[model samples]
Target: MTVKTRIYLVRHGETAWNAGGKFQGHSDIPLSERGRKQAKALAERLSNLKIDAFYSSDLSRARETAGILAEPHRGTVYYLPELREINFGRWEGLTFKEIAEAYGELSTRWWASPLTIQIPAGESLQQVVDRCTRAVAGIITRHAGETVVVAAHGGVIRVIVGAALGLDLNHFWQLRLDNVSLTVLEYHGPEKAILELFNDTCHLHEK
Candidate 1:
């Protein structure tokens, strides 16, 4: 029987920037109280699953969310900078409207063709795809037939999913991943994988 490795791709809980519609990029913002509550709810949702490993962006938001999710299983989270969000460069704390006003057509062009345009000091979508995929590749190699949890930022998770499905990087924007959402990818081999779930936030339902 060919064993497939299942990866629970998660977006970190909400942050102040997230609530304010600011670009978090590589900013090291921590989760808010609501974000922590969201993480707790997600943790309860996955408490019964047999998770073999846990990975997360080195950012405090993702780190804290991973910590909460792993609390039930006694899992140690492997933090990686590569799993961090697309470096928004100089636009780290600005909203999209602010970016558009400040950057003019450049921002519009970037939104339309992210793969081709570089973000002033931030990373292009292609560059993000390269590094994030490399990191996930290593994780899949180490645990070929097991299940793992990868908690990261929304943009990072989108690119990883885009690459997995062989979609153009531009489509990354179209894939809307909610904070603390669950997205699963099952990999049977390096080139063979399946997106079992995407953006499942059913766990956030009112208690």
Candidate 2:
């Protein structure tokens, strides 16, 4: 029987920026009080799972969320900087309307053609895919056949899932990753991967 490595991809809990609907790409903002409570609740929901390893983006929000989950299992948490959110360049911290007002048609084109268009002073969707793919590949290689949890941003989670499914980066928005949501992926061999779940927020019902 082929051993399958299970990966739990979790999006970090909400932050102040998330509540405000602002683009928080690459920002090091900490989680809001609600976010902290959500993480704790998620920890409780996952308490019974035997996690072999835990990993997270280096950003404060993701790191803290991972810490909360890891505390119960005492699992080793690894920080992967490459798992950080996509750089929004000059558009960082801007709301959707603000970006449209500032860049007009350019912003529309960016949303419509993210994979091909590069954000001025930031990364393109393809660039994000490359970085996230590298980080995921590295983790899978190191922990094959084990259950691992990776806490990261929504954007990063989208790209990682896309790459695993062999989908184009332009279709990244199709994957809806909510704050504190969990996605599960399984790797059966050197090249085969399966997405078992996406954007599961069942724990939020307890909140």
Candidate 3:
């Protein structure tokens, strides 16, 4: 039997910026009270899983969420900067409306063709796909046949899932990853990754 490695891809809990619909790209904001509660709920939801490894983006929000989820299993979370959200540069901390008001056509293009649109001084979606997928590849290789958890940003998780499904950067916005949502990916081999779950937020119902 071929061993399949399972990856539980979790988007970090809600943040103040998330509630405000502000761009939180690489901002290092801590989780809000609601976010903390959401993380704890998600932790409880996954407490029974046989997780072999835990990993997270180095950002505080993701790190804290991973910390919560790792508690039940007594696991150490491996922090990877490569899993950080796409850097929004000037767009960081701004709302979509604000971005549209400030950047006009550039912001429109960012929404329509994020794969090709560059954020003034931030990373393009392709760049996010490259770095985040590389970290995922490393995790899969390191923990083959084992179940691992990765807590990261919405944008980061989206790119990783899309990549696993052979979807390119153009479909970036299609993967709707909500805060504290859970996604599962099973890797049987390099080209045999299956998206078992996507954006599951049932645990948050307890909140």
Q: Which candidate achieves the best lDDT against the true structure?
A: 1
Quote the RMSD, in angstroms, for model 1. Answer: 0.8
lDDT of 2 at 43: 98
Residues 80-132, candidate 1, lDDT per residue (tens digit)?
Answer: 99999999899999999999999999898998999888998898888888889
lDDT (C-alpha) at residue 72 in model 2 = 97
- Tens digit per residue, CA lDDT, model 3, 120-167: 889889889889878988898899899999999989988888888888
Candidate 2: residue 31 lDDT (0-100): 97
The better candidate by lDDT, 1 or 2, is: 1
TM-score ranking from best to worst?
1, 3, 2
Which regions of candidate 2 fall more than 4 Å away from where they truly are? Answer: none
Q: Lowest-lDDT window of 10 residues in candidate 1?
A: 168-177
* Candidate 2 residue-wise lDDT, 36-95, digit = tens: 988998999999999999999999999999999999998878999999999898988899
RMSD (Cα, Å) of model 3: 1.2
